[model samples]
Target: MIIHKSNNVTVFQSAVFQLNTTVVATEDLILVVDPGYLPYEIEQIRIYVDKIKDDRPIYLFFTHSDFDHIVGYGAFPDAKTIASEQFVTNNLKGSQLQAAINYDDEFYIVRPYQLEYPRIDFMIKEDGEQFQVGKTLFNFHYAFGHNHDGLIVTVESENLAIVGDYLSDIEFPFVYFSFEQYGRTLKTLKSIFEKNSERTLITSHGTVTSDQSQITKRISDSYEYLEFVKIQGSGEQFEQFMEEKKYIFSTIFRKRHQDNIMVYERECEHS
Candidate 1:
């Protein structure tokens, strides 16, 4: 667990767990973004929050409701949790938690970690509205397509945005919920990044970026990589493509297995 300072907040990098949790603190409050996997880590985060600003009312915001992102919610009992209405309606309830567990067990070969239903505070902004916590105002932009309810949070004070899985060192995009709008979403994000080149973009998987050129390049590369795979004919062709594109492949290969390969194949066959 390595913690890096991001102007007024701290971003905790979880390499082993493959998630990045961020904490934003103000004089009277603490705002935590996208708590990751591991019940123990969540407890640690709660303890940290309490120690630093005792009973300051931690606000847990879910950028999206993927298994890795929400597993820690159980640890923050007193805090209020907010997320896209679509996420809560579709995937954050009790039955949804069971479904998530089954989904992981069948596909990712992992059991769903325990989860606490967040307070169900509010809906996502319809037109990129802003949510204020104390002195800082965090802008919530609806940038779906990677997932139907995905969001990007921009902090007004730091000139930085916490973009969850919108970009990564990984070559291909892992989108669930909607595939048809994936390309358009990437384009939208690229446009936003271009407009805010001086503002830092923090991805869940890797480094903070201020370079729009690199962000653009990564998105382009990700799309191109997926396109190349889509061009391949079948599952066997996908295997060959993977071998050829070994330069861009990562541990996401074997573990994610059929999902990672089939998604590209589906894009080729359908898109």
Candidate 2:
């Protein structure tokens, strides 16, 4: 599903989880971010890229080392890849690939391209790292917690931030990694949004919002959710903070909420 489209940026959402894959094109370059999910959906993205890419170089930007985010890597063999330095050196490389393979096996899905972890041609080594392609400038910031290797890419040229698997309208925090790091990540995002009020946000799941107010609200929601989780981790649950956000909370995310509590508690234990 093409959620947002223009001459510069095109956002595609997959049926699997409303997972988003964004394509950003400029005068001299075409960039693909986290191409993912089903085989046909990836083909849609691949075909579309070829259609507009012309003779300009194609670049693939993987926000992190997650299976869903990297599932479509095989389809774009000719494109150069970009990812965080941590992502390049991730210890779970095999496990990530196995998860993708497992998903395909369960669905009996066959693809023309081989399933493999993406090889990064360019790595974002530090926060505030800037890379220029043609006339477009990309700013990479560390966005950890949801995952260790996540990087928030700010396309200054497009006034867009491509955040991987964070700030979703349909879900709350899914702390698969460190809870403390996740808390810091939210603070970092809040800081980012506070400064770049004009930038549009392309979260990995759910909505692609350009509204500054909506973007600010999402950051606020995340902070509220994080504090509530912290309260729960302390064994002092006051009326359940999630009660107010029932619109975004559901059975699936509630499960993730429980997981978040456990992750937070464990972090407290070790910290």
Candidate 3:
């Protein structure tokens, strides 16, 4: 369903994971960020973008290498693809594709387009790398933590950001990578917030927010969670920490919180 819409942007939320597919259209370019989840939902995004984008170039920007983020790749064969250099070179491409295949097989869901890993047409190599398409300026920042190749895209023209998995309201930091890396990404995000004026923040898993205080609140939540994970004692439960923060508990998110604990433990050993 359409959660939010503005002059040149429309945000589509999938029922599966509250996964968002953001579309930003202009005279020269139509950018689609991580269009995904069920096959029908992806098709709807494609149809909607196709209808509005007349002679503009379509760009499919993958924020990370996660299976869910890249699962809808084959749906838009004609769109020029975009991703971070790390994502393009990640060795886990085969497993990522298989994860998508596994999801389809488990649910007996069928899709018309072939499910394949995307071949990026444009690659973001460094932080603050800018891509210009007419009046739109896409500033790409490498955001590592949730996934090693995670990216955060900021549309300077719109003063809007498409953050891959970070700064989410629905969930806390899902650090599958490293706690330190996640913290670093949070700092980067905070810097971004400071540099920009009041901005609209679009997260993949949560509702969008334009209020600066709310954006600041999400960043504070991340920093607090990062600190919270560091206090992990021997065999301590993440659920305990979750309760202390008054964060909503769920079986699925419980597993993610546990995984955060494990990642923190591993990072602690290395440090």
Candidate 4:
């Protein structure tokens, strides 16, 4: 369903993960960011795009290469795709992505189109890469930590930042990559927020907010969680940390949080 729409931007939230599929409708193009989740959800995005896209070119942007994020690639086959250069060149790219698709297919999951990895026609290799779509200017930044190949897009004219998976109010820092890199990424996001204080920050898994306090809190909370895990380890202290943050202690998330500690330990050992 459409979660938010104003002027030329529309954000659709998938029921499965609250994954956001953002549509930026400009006079010259329609930009779709991370269209994903169940089959019907993707179809709804396609239908909406078809409704608003009037012969203009459609562009697809994947915030990262996660299975859920790229599952809908085939839905917009003709759209020009964009991503970080690292995502385009990863050695495990095809196999890992296909594995994700296979996992979904194992559940008898049906999609409107055949599952396929996105063919990235445009790559953002440098920080502050700017592109113009109609009257809007989009600045793309390479964001690491949550994932090695994540991106944070700023739509200057619309005053919106389509952050891939970082700064989520509902999720703690899920560092799939380097914890050190994640810390750097958060700092980068904080800097971006400082400059574009007026822009609404839209995270993939949480509600959109322009409130500076909420944004600042999310950044500091994530950073503090990392520090707590690093110094405290996965012991009573870590458990207490989780409790203080009101983090629900689920077996799955607990395991994920534990893994974060493990990764940090391994990195420290090697360092």
Give Cα-based local distance difference scores for all models: 0.67, 0.86, 0.88, 0.85
**What tens-digit string does per-residue lDDT give for candidate 4 at 1-271?**
8888888988999986788899998878899999977889889999989998989999999999887788889889889999999889876678768876787868888766677777899999898899877776889987888778998999887788899988887778888888998988888889999987898888998688889899999899998989877874676766776677767635666788888888888888999
Candidate 1 backbone collisions, by pair: none
Candidate 3 has an lDDT of: 0.88
Q: Per TM-score, what order, best first?
A: 3, 4, 2, 1
lDDT tens digits by residue: candidate 2, 88-112: 9999999999998999999898988
TM-score for all models, in order of appearance: 0.79, 0.94, 0.95, 0.94
Error of 1 at 208 (Å): 3.0
**Ranking according to lDDT, highest score first:** 3, 2, 4, 1
Model 2 clash pairs?
none
**Which stretches of model 2 miss by more than 4 angstroms?**
233-243, 246-249
Choose the strongest candidate by lDDT. 3
- Please give the lDDT score at residue 137 for candidate 2: 91
Candidate 3 TM-score versus the reference: 0.95
Q: List per-candidate RMSD values in Å.
A: 4.2, 2.2, 1.8, 1.6
